[model samples]
Target: MNLFGKFATVGGATLLSRVFGFGREMMMASALGVGPVADAFNLAFRFPNLFRRLFAEGAFNAAFIPLFARSLESDGEGGAKRFASEIFSTLFVVLTTLTVLAMIFMPTLVRTIIAPGLAVCVDTVDTGRQAISCETRFDLTVTLSRIMFPYLACMSLMAMVSGILNAFRRFFAAAVAPTLLNIILIAVLLYAHWVGADTVTIGHLMSWGVLAAGVSQLALVVAAMRLAGFSVALGVPRWTQNLKRLLILAGPAALIGGITQINLFVGQAIASFKPGAVSILQYADRPYQLPLGMVGVAIGVVLLPELARALKAGHLREAQHTQNRSLEFALFLTLPAAVALFLIPEPIIRVIYERGAFDPTATPAVASVLGLYALGLPAFVLIKVFSPGFFAREDTKTPMRATLVSAVANTVLSFVLFQFYAEQGIALATTLAGWLNAGLLFLGLWRRGLWEIDRALVKRGALVLLASLAMGALLLVELHLLSDWLVPAAGLHRQLAALAFLVASAMAVYFACTVLFGAVDRSMLMKLAKGRRGRAKAAE
Candidate 1:
């Protein structure tokens, strides 16, 4: 598919999933609010999510894509299926074992890794600007974490299956798999509320819902992969060149490329002590994930195959060009998003999540973290897009080394920043780490002279950045003008209108200014705007 069509196909599916997720969060905020119960739910879910990214999206994709593409290229459909079957079978056993271990060690694990959740139990709970006993916070976290812990097993399996499906060129079911998760969560929340489930029991109900979402997501993706003519079996393991290759690549990929997520886990740990910190991070993560999911994941998935093919054919120039173009697209798209989030995240969060359990105080706090996250949005996307450059060339060590640097930087920054800014500081630290990672990657590639942005790309990038800044300024003006109409100081109606105005004005201003200044290439913009579609950056 052309870049635009592929983005639309993948991004559209992602957008649907994110919107459903937003709905789920909305329901959650209404029911849970920003309290200990909410923290428990967030804490419980993140463990599974952390592992899910490790095994499914970030780490799994890093290893799976190159191997899948290679299998398909050299061995045809039959070869690819056999390879997938072998890996799938082994993965099942591994994940099953891992799940049991996690459950058995859940408490100890939480204490060690997510210790803040445990510590919160010893501290006071912030119950709407008031303090409650530490036992309440700790007990809530412990119970909820236990209930939702099984989701790790379910989602890990789901991610493995999704990788297989993507290899089979079946993107839709896997792409939409997350929608089921969000949908299930939404339904559970709505039902629980409608039936007037006791407030005390809502945390327990939500934990079960988290588990349900995991099972549904895993089962759906596995079924789709099976229907796509691939199956996994837990057969006796044997050494294979492909398996060995995957392991060799995967180890470093996970170590290096997956550092960002590791830092997130770190952030989670650090944020645990602060009241409502975990929930605030989760709320902010929603919008931050939108662009990351759409562009970053899509590019990582698509470009690796393309680059692997080119590299396998000894087409270095083609691979290099692809990297450059994808980087440009990522930078072009994400820069503006960063600016927008930094400037007007309050209205965005207010419109999307400021009802039910999510209150006004929660809005700006969440928005503040979102802004912090936005600072690294472009880098986050770029890392995913550019990573295959190293991976496709069978060089994972450099990225791995860079990742180690970033992980340390992230950890150090978290400790230092948390002392000052609390929850948002942890987020900002993560953003700083990401920018460092991206800078290092680009510098590495440049040192090897593998990535080059010619004068055209440089000029184009400048135009995009300049125009984006113009758009940002326009938003600053319109936001103040539309403040009363957007959220005002009170009432739902005014808040709703104010939000609509903020969105419309921002869109009008950004598009108008960028289009006028020729930020996006005019010809390309028209083609893309008209839905003709073209290659856009993978990471953004």
Candidate 2:
């Protein structure tokens, strides 16, 4: 398989999902605003995603794929199919039991996850000088969380199907599943407005939308898996060797690779102390995810199975090359995206989010968090790309250590920053932890002699950095020139037009310089354009 080709198809689909996500969030911002409804929805939405990332996306995939690859390589097609069927049967029952427990005890879970925020509304705060009531904020969060917590059950089923589909090296269905969530939310929000619903009603409708999204996503991937020459038979099951291997891998991978989600959980816990903190963080985090999910994660997902296949065949060199290429691509694209986020967050936020209930006050606040997140974007993407090396080797223990350290770093930083910066402080903590996570991963890889940087790669990376810096400078200048145009007292049409101009200009500068300087060579471009599955080679 040509690694790059697969990423393109999968990444392109993921990009469409992100675009739909932007639309969904846009509607969310307008309908719910950055107040109680927004905070409640964000708090409710994040935990399931937290577990999804922890259990299903990273750790589970890390363990499952190599085993599935082995089944395919050693035991043939029949063996691989049997392995997948057992995994499906086992995961379905386990996740169903867990979800039922979670749903039944969701209120306690909500309070535990956002204890500080809930405490504010549920308790009275005392100071020597003053006392304040926090009942409104606390009650709002608890109420919102209750409405949306069932999303976990839906996503778990989807995540299992996602894993099975991905194990078959069919990424399109799984990669595209998330877009449905975005689409469903958008549809719900629009429907609420069409019928002239109030904010509370809209929030309630959107909560149901979340559950519906999970079902839609699960169905989409299950169908895609069937089309890709796989069918998961649901039934009573026993734990096979493949299942055991998955548990062993997923357990450590979950602890290690779940740092990012855990960091968000901690941040939300802190944000719960202040009104609207969670909501602002969610808005800022959305734009950041666009690049991370579409490109960074797409590359990682596509490369995992490829790396496993190569390793099973004792093709270490191919595996190494694959890792190198994956890092380069992730860094090259993510660096520019980081630059864009850091350089122009305010305008981007204003254009997309500053309307209806989302006021101008929210723009700089959300933008500030987005800027901090940009500092770690490259590291965040690199984590996805590099961890597969350890995962494909069935080494999940190393990343787990790094995950804990990063999580601790994030927690400490959140408290330290929140002393004054408030919600942005929590975001900064996460940003710093991401950098820490990336640094530790690179160090571990080097210690094991698993990663090395070629001088050519170093030279090219430097050039990309310089080119992106130049692009950032250009964007800053343009933004200043059009500051009047961008941050204006106007309708949505005018604001959106300026945003379009800004994005186009940034794209022009970044791509133009990369191509002009031959920093992105044609072959590399062709490979990226083709994705990880190299039908390009076959075509040639």
Candidate 3:
């Protein structure tokens, strides 16, 4: 299928997952809120999620998909399957060993790296009216981390299978796996609520749910791989030449992932010192992630495979065109989202999370963080777009070096900022670091002559920015006019109505401005749709 079609398939599935993820977060906010249990759970969950991103989503795919795609292109089905089996066996062994080791040392991991602040006793004032003790939170985080670490192993293997499927141009199943995770977590939340479980108990159940979700997600992609006419079976580990090359690429990719995740770990560790700070940051982060996951990740997933295939077949022009259009498409969606998040964060956070245990007083802090995060949204999406230019060419070292700079910036800034601005300062540091990372990646791609921006793309990007600014202006006006209607005192129905109107109005203004400015046209969209169908037919 065409790039746009593949993106739609992946983005649509991701959108569904993000929607359900919102529901899951809403339930979590109600059930746990910004309490000690919530803080502990977020920290615990971060352990496995950190590795999952490092191994499964980030490094493994960066190393695996391109090679897997090239194998299919040159060596055909048998060669591709053999390569996949070797990688799968090696990945399974490595991840399993890592998970076991991590689980065994969960307490040391938590104490040393994850959330050392949990060790100290805090005064009641520091506890912020939450009765759960710091020591209790510390113990619970260790236990929950142990419970969830196995998920990393499951998901890493699952990611390899996903890479195989993506190589085969099968995006649906892998795209939908995350939705299953949200679904399972939501179910566990509901069941816990029904059972009248305590917050700590609910947290424990949720961690277990993560492991279960991993298994379910792995089973799903495995089934998808089989259905796509590839059988990837478990075998003893082997150190073949292909495996050596994969390891060579994967080492830097993994380091890059590690560096990037360290930024998050630093932010969270700093946030953990204050009660409810981690949960507050998490709540603020979820809304912006909707667009990021839907657009950025979808573009990254589809773009990498597409670029790999093009470059493999010696189609440099095709690769460059794909990169440009992907960037344009990403900016077209991401700019408006950044504007909305920056301008109306309070209303968005209040509407989604203010109910239940999420305190009204916490709204301002969460909203501020959300707005700061929005400032970096475009940078985040651009990273997704541009990094593929290097990864597809097996140039992982450049991004790793760039990530190291950003990581150091993030780590130093996070500490420096937290001393003054607290959680919001850490959020700001993350935003600035993201922009730095994107800039470095872009410069590297341009220097290597891999990325070229045409006049049309620049004009469209300028128009998108202008349209987004216009939308932001409209949103400020709407929020001012309906300010009272967005508050908790306005009741849920009124708040929902005002939010809906604001979103609809913003979308209308942005789209209208885009058309007027000649950024995008109906004919272009129709042609894209037609091209998608033609490509799909050709694939069949």
TM-scores of all candidate predictions against the true structure: 0.92, 0.91, 0.95
Clash totals in order: 15, 17, 0
lDDT of 2: 0.77
Worst ten in a row by lDDT for model 2: 124-133
> Where does model 1 exceed 4 Å of error?
124-133, 487-490, 525-540
Instruction: Quantify how close model 2 is to the true structure by its C-alpha RMSD in Å.
Output: 4.2
TM-score of candidate 3 versus the correct structure, residues matched by position: 0.95
lDDT (tens digit, per residue) of candidate 3 on 1-540: 667878899999899999999999999998887888888889988877777666655467888887887788789988888898888888788878888888888889888888977766474323333466666778888999899888888878887888788777788898888898899999999999899888778899999999899899999999888888789767999889999999889877776644445666789987888888899888887898899888977887888878887898899998888898998998899999998999999989888988777778888999999999999889888888877888889989899899889988998999899999999998899899999999999999998789889887899999999999999999988988998999889999999999999999999999999989988746877898788798899999
Q: Is candidate 1 or candidate 3 better by lDDT?
A: 3
What lDDT does the true structure give each of the candidates?
0.77, 0.77, 0.85
Tens-place lDDT digits, model 1, residues 1-540: 565455557667777888888788777877777887777777777777777666655466677777887778889888887887777677677767877777777777777786555654556655553455767666666677777877777776676677777665566776777788888888888888889885457778878888888888888887887777777666876678878888888888766656667888899888887778888988888888888877776676667767777888998887777777777777777888889888888888887777765777788899899989998999888888768778777889898888889999999999999999999899999999998998898888889977877765787678878877887888888877776666635677777777666657766776776667666667876676555332344333
RMSD of 1: 3.9
Q: Where is the poorest 10-residue window by lDDT in model 3? A: 121-130
Model 3 spans > 4 angstroms off? 55-58, 124-130, 255-262, 528-540
Best by lDDT: 3
Sequence-dependent TM-score of model 2: 0.91
